[model samples]
Target: MSVRSLSATLALSAALVGVGVPTASARPATYELSGDAGGSKFEGIGYDARTQRYYVSETTGGEIHRGQLRSAAATEWLPGDGTDGRWTARGVTVDSRGRVYVAGGPNGIDHPGAPDLWVYDRDGRLLAALRTGVPNAFLNDLVIGPDGAAYVTNSNAPQVFRVAQEHGRWTIRTWADATATIATQTGFNLGGIVLSPDRRALVVPQGNVGKLWRFALSTGTVSAVDTGAADLVNADGLVQDGHRLWVVRNFSRVLTTLQLSSDGRTARLASATPTDPDRVLTTAKLAQGRLLLVDSKFDEPTAVPPYQVITMTPPRR
Candidate 1:
């Protein structure tokens, strides 16, 4: 769809969906990302609440974009095209220490010398570019754990990699392997992930099977989360506030809300709201009481410019 048609369709959908839309006075509604000549497509987004800065990753190349909460345009923070041995980037999350962690999706699968993930300090200096040592690892999305480490999801396999600095040295290891519990599928096996409100477990969605799995942080045991009757197919990025969870179904263009049990074992579907029909929002981060969603443009046959990270009010339960 053309840009004009897409905006009009989104405006109409917002009115019909009955959700609170962001007015221009409140925010710009959408934050633009710097584009590349290759028709840069984006995926994961990370927000630094402390600095009011947000980071976005370009999928076509390993470039990372940075924008501020008050700014309308993001500038390129990191260059792609094999810079730092990174050819492509995926999920991104910022640690409490202002460090940025980026997932290299399928970058290491074909090239053994390529990095599977990268870590950068607050100044955008490369700290580490290491591989998980897992074969065919498709590092998709990641979330910062309570222990001040990054837990990344492997889309090609049922595994989670823990990337952290140990004894002044950076290391990447397979922290949890759920091959027996969660079966690997054709498409993305695991996509979006979030920590439970209690901070006891990691809640992840298996997009191919439309299932939720809780990975216990203490024991590393994986169990299925009972999300009764919620069609969570294509579930991508996850955002959690207390027991409330928002699941962004990318291709389906649906934002699903669920109330989780205190222990994070079960969930009740609250609502399934339709998103803009023209964009595929891959992931989101909650910042300043609003959601900054990445409009991935993965659905477009040929993506256009003015790529954006749109803002929306949290859906009411």
Candidate 2:
């Protein structure tokens, strides 16, 4: 239970007895921000509190773009020299020192030995190079948690892993293992993972099966973060502002948030963006008090490229 030796616990995924979740409805307004990036598949998004800027990474193009996140219309943050314009970027993270880290993989295929995690300054200057050799670790989304450790998600392996800055190389640890083989399900890929404000729990959404899982940092055990969805809802990105767990249901097309219990298990739906039937994959990012979401435009075979990033300033009632 004490994660000092990296000899973490190996407990089987629990909550197998609960087969179904009761249906419920949530209320959140859909606000669309005006901007387009040519249908790029936006993988990871983060907001800088220091500069008040929003960063979204392009999965396919390797473009880590900057954008102004405001109540009004927003524009894309074009790449820079030796910064954005010069390098291919994937999962991105802005550290406490204001350093930005991006993940680099060979476009789509397995480019082994290729450093996937890249670092940049606030001005987009390449700072550090990081690579992890976790089997099938196709880096997707990256986030610097409240404790300052960088956590990443891999789509292919469908596992949530972490990296620590030790000596110079980014020492890696297999922090989260949400393998689908344990669940007897096909699509349990952990897409986005984030820690709660208390640093006791991690809220993660699966892209294939549309489920949210809450794992305890102390116990290293996982439970159903959200049990409501029973189909291909495609839960993707996640972020937590201390208390509530905000998740983007990619296939269901809704932004939902729920409160985490003090014990770090069981996630109940608290709020959800209002959507009409047939709407889909509502991706989201939470920064400060603002929630940024995008209405994915589906162009299958090609997929949803540069999914539109929309901003909504929720009225605090």
Candidate 3:
């Protein structure tokens, strides 16, 4: 279908299904890291419940760092040795098996990696570097699907790539393409992604446009979500639990939570809580029953040393 038709359909759905109000509030705590490893530009966040570890990826050099839930120190899991000049990290996520997945891409138009996913063991050993095979793909935030598949969003493209282990070897494929609507419009499309509660579909947001969408894996269908607000500008990272989805607006400097429908097509704004205005925050994850966020500070004049991961309770309904 065309983008216009799809948008009209979505509008009808929003009107028929009904929309919910959004609430804004604030309550958070900050944890500082020990060294320069903490200062480099960081973006993604992931948590391993079994080991009680939190993982973050640096945007400057594709370095992976790990820290304990309550520790002030964070150590480098993968050093940013600049193996490839263009190598930069975006999103980091951990699976139930304790494996870590880090997204890598170019830092700018001049420097570009092959847009890959770096899979590592729990101890930070490089297990595999699976290339997305998509041209100029900015592989961003990712989520592990119910069937153990890894689905990654491409900020430069209008699609989500799926990576799954097959016969002990990992393979990558384009799970669904959001070719219509704002998918291919421009800048930072398909930023953060998460699966539905039932795992039958995926929900995603466009960073530049502040629009949310749902893609059905079974039928390759796409639909818009009624955010109630005109725009969720700078919507960067997304974390979901049960029926709630938390979206981090990097430029807005706030974390907004939305209550999603079971099908993942619709959401009502639950709350928008203020984050540290001095630090540009990106991704978030649930650790120890609290929400943890990374201070990416991507747009700051000079990155301050001893970066931090802030923890807080999700705003109440």
Q: For candidate 1, write residues 1-317 as lDDT tens digits.
A: 24663576568665765554554554567898878855879998999999999999998888999999887889999999899998889999999999999999999985687899999998989999998878899999999999998999999999988999999999999999999999888999898889988999999999988999999999889999999999999999999999999999999988899999877899999988788777798999999888899989898776878698988787868
The whole-model C-alpha lDDT of candidate 2 against the native structure comes to 0.55
Model 1 regions more than 4 Å off: 1-17
| Top TM-score model | 1
lDDT of 2 by residue, 185-277 (tens): 465366677776667767666667666666677666777754453332566767566566666676665556666555445565666643322
Ranking by TM-score: 1, 3, 2
Pairs in steric clash, model 3: none
TM for every model, in the order presented, reads 0.96, 0.70, 0.85
Local distance difference test, candidate 1: 0.89
Best-fitting candidate, measured by lDDT?
1
lDDT per model, in order?
Answer: 0.89, 0.55, 0.74
